[model samples]
Target chain A: MSAKKTEYGEDQDLLMKKSDRRTFLKGCSVAAAAASAALTSGCIPSVAAENSEEMKLRWQEFFKKNYRLMTQEEKDATVARLERLAKLRDGLDVQMGSYPPLKGVLYGYGFNITRCEGFMECVAACVKENNLDRKTNTQYIRIFEMEPGKLDPGTGDGQYYHKVPVENKFYMGTQCFHCENAPCTKACPTKATWREPDGIVVVDYDWCIGCRYCQAACPYYGRRFNWGKPEIPRQEINLRQHYLGNRVRPKGKMEKCTFCIQRTRKGRLPACVEACPTGARVFGNLLDPDSEIRYVLKHKKVFRMKEELGTDPKFWYFID
Target chain B: MQLFLTGLILLVGITTLFWGRARASESSFLDEVKKSTARFDNRSVPLVKEVTEDTVLSHEKYQGGSFRVLARKKNIERYQCSNCHNDKPVTVNRGAELTHGDIVLNHGSAERGLVCIDCHSPEQRDYLEDKKGRKIDFDHSYDLCGQCHFRQKRDWIGGAHGKRVVNWAGDRVVYNCTTCHDPHSPRFEKRFPATYSVPLD
Candidate 1:
């Protein structure tokens, strides 16, 4: 057969190789289909809810393959099912993006150490944009307030209540750095977490086994596990989502910052950077020599949180 | 040995010229980037709200290196100073109740304080006056700011000191100085964070 192209520019020959594995996975799928058919046709006794649209969508979601191995058709089908499921369950018409990484773009972030005033604006923006669990107050970004005379963050306080920018204190913000040599991605037993071509570290929620191995491996405390089902207010749910990024995740899965993949993939600034009133946060294509991140690297005296660990974090901190 | 030395000199001269030419095309480089990233107009993706009241740096002073800045006039509460300060002779009334009482005029150091007329033109209230007595438009207030804060101006020009709006790519539009900092009171005020972190035990 003539070779056809896929989103990643992979040919049909490569897809055939992936389908070979799909055949092996079909054993589990066949069983699920059998059970689903019995439940739908009343051959097997089940509650009324079992035959509902949400239940059917869950069955389809259960048998889905890893996001990486899915073909273009499969990806589209998965996104469609999720969209339909959101409508069925929450009565919310949500759009889920399965966009591939943009060509010739490597995202990087710049945080101005001097400019940050311990304002948790980035954290608030992240929580809303990512639709984070409000029950546990899950926040991906942390702004640490540090004392003067030392640059050490170990003694810094991530939790400070009172008026901010207290006399001699400085603020430093931290999140998933999307490191080049990420230990968290390496420690994922199921390969559920991996870095995209554009340098965003993404977690496939369905594929993740809730191992928590990645959490232990991360030196930056970047990964967060959902101990219980995420409870988001119906009104506050961000309708825009990305499959690998901020799509509503089930309990027992791992999630972290994907640099707002839903927004950045569309060439928009990450929500944190957008919400920053001080102009302290900078986000841009690292490969573009003329990008603001590049200019910051060239002109400012910048440093990462921990260089000894050799994570090669794309996130940087700079002071005037 | 003589041929090698001549070749070395020629190579150095050629390299210098190429470097100079590349340095001169900084603005053109941004134009090219904007054109190449034009394919980002994906219909499936909703377009980000575009800013319209934006102005570019002048080619005469900025050497053709233009970047987008939000227009200040639109945000200004009381614009067209000419509306009130119309072509009338200036009246110095320290005794009369102040027209602009809200203005604190706390810019500059305690000893070297700035009055309204220092930056604002008494002769032409609508326009700002630079150190050289040049009339500067409110839209291009960066020029007026660059007169004193040249370092910050240089950084802003290089995309370091300011915030970019809308998209990180294509047609770079940045917030001008007055957008973030009040020209009269430039320092940012300390305020409470949006949310608090988990309290430490």
Candidate 2:
């Protein structure tokens, strides 16, 4: 079998080796089928003989290269194939595009602990916006209602709060802070999860090896592993997707919040920020001094969760 | 015949005086006339008093503000204050049997010695009244709210208080103060959130 060489010679060699192994397996399977046919009275059915569109798609998916290594043409082809796969599997006409980070903008978020009414509007909006797995009940943003005068998240109760904005209690929300010094990216063996130029930590779903190392390494418990196929209802699926963001995640992949990359990259606010009724959530460019996030940082008493770790999280919680 | 004519004229004059007093006290006669005429005339009378062509005012264009504040009139729930109050002159002393009986003015009554007319315009029930006694639209409620909550108003202007909507970049459109807080009862009440917290095991 002839092998084609690309710019990534090492990756090309690996691909060639994989193809060679696959051909060898195919030959072995054929030989095994012949031997079985000779032994049996009737002709044995060959598994490889039934080549369907789905089978071809599965093969293409298996051979798909890492997102980082993919050429522009390869990326486009992969996006097309993924779109086709989504349509075939879920009947969703999803528009998946890889949006590059905006120039001269580093996205940062601020949460007013005083203003957050413990209303999970942001959480609900996030689940819908990101197309998170409904079966696993996957959520990126977790609002913890803390006791009065206590700032520690360790003592905060995320669950079992009957009523929100409980007297003397304040709410603090946590998500992927998109740390400037992200530990998850360091822990990722496949280099699937990394921070973009605009400071959003994103996971290339196809590239993730489902090792859960990132999950363990993350101090904020930001990453989520898809144990099974993300069971999203067909009608509820968000068609607007970023390739590295809220795109329909496959099973056994790690996923996290990308700050609504599809929306934010286009100068729109994140779903959580828009959904917040109390204006508790603030998001804007950290670079722009005139931006709301900058104003909050400058005026309010802002603190990050696990600040001692020195992850340098872009997300900050402030009190009026 | 002369006595009968004089008695009839005197009786008619007394009746007219009584009718005028009744109309003045309770302007329901005009409402009744309107209701009766409305059946025949399909065109409904305007609920809000028509601002004369000369006195008509437009909201000052917010130029170079950090964010574009949304008009409150669009967002007010069950906003038909003028429906009942248009023809009726608001009595200064309604004797605690409030017209807006549901509205509990707990915000400024205890601390600031404020009444309904303090913020809300007595003449225009739909619009708010500012410290300068200028008629303010419901859209510009921040002006009225800013009178007392100056710190919060400053924070809002500076982007620390209130919610911003739509795109974060470019023209920011923020919710007005009255959008989240009820002017009658400004405190945010404790209630069940939209979704429950996912238990972190």
Error of 2 at B92 (Å): 20
What are the per-model DockQ values? Answer: 0.26, 0.19
lDDT of 2 by residue, B87-189 (tens): 6676657635455576677776566766788888888878889889988778778877887798898778778888665667655566678768888878877
Worst 10 residues of 2 chain A by lDDT: A1-10
Model 1: per-residue lDDT, tens digit, B1-201?
999999999999999998976654442222333444323322233445555665664322221135577778867776887866776665766524336776667688999988887788879888999889999888788888888898888877776787888778766678888988988888877788899777311
- Local accuracy of candidate 1 as per-residue lDDT tens digits, A1-320: 01111323452345457767777777777787777776666754455445566776777788787787787899999999999988887788999989888876778899998889877888999999998888888888888889876566667898887888888889888889988767997798877888777878899999899999999999988889888767888889899988988888988999999999988988788999989988889998876767788778879999887876667788989988
Per-residue lDDT of A317 in model 2: 90
Model 2, C-alpha of A173: deviation from truth (Å):
0.9
Whose lDDT is greatest here?
Answer: 1
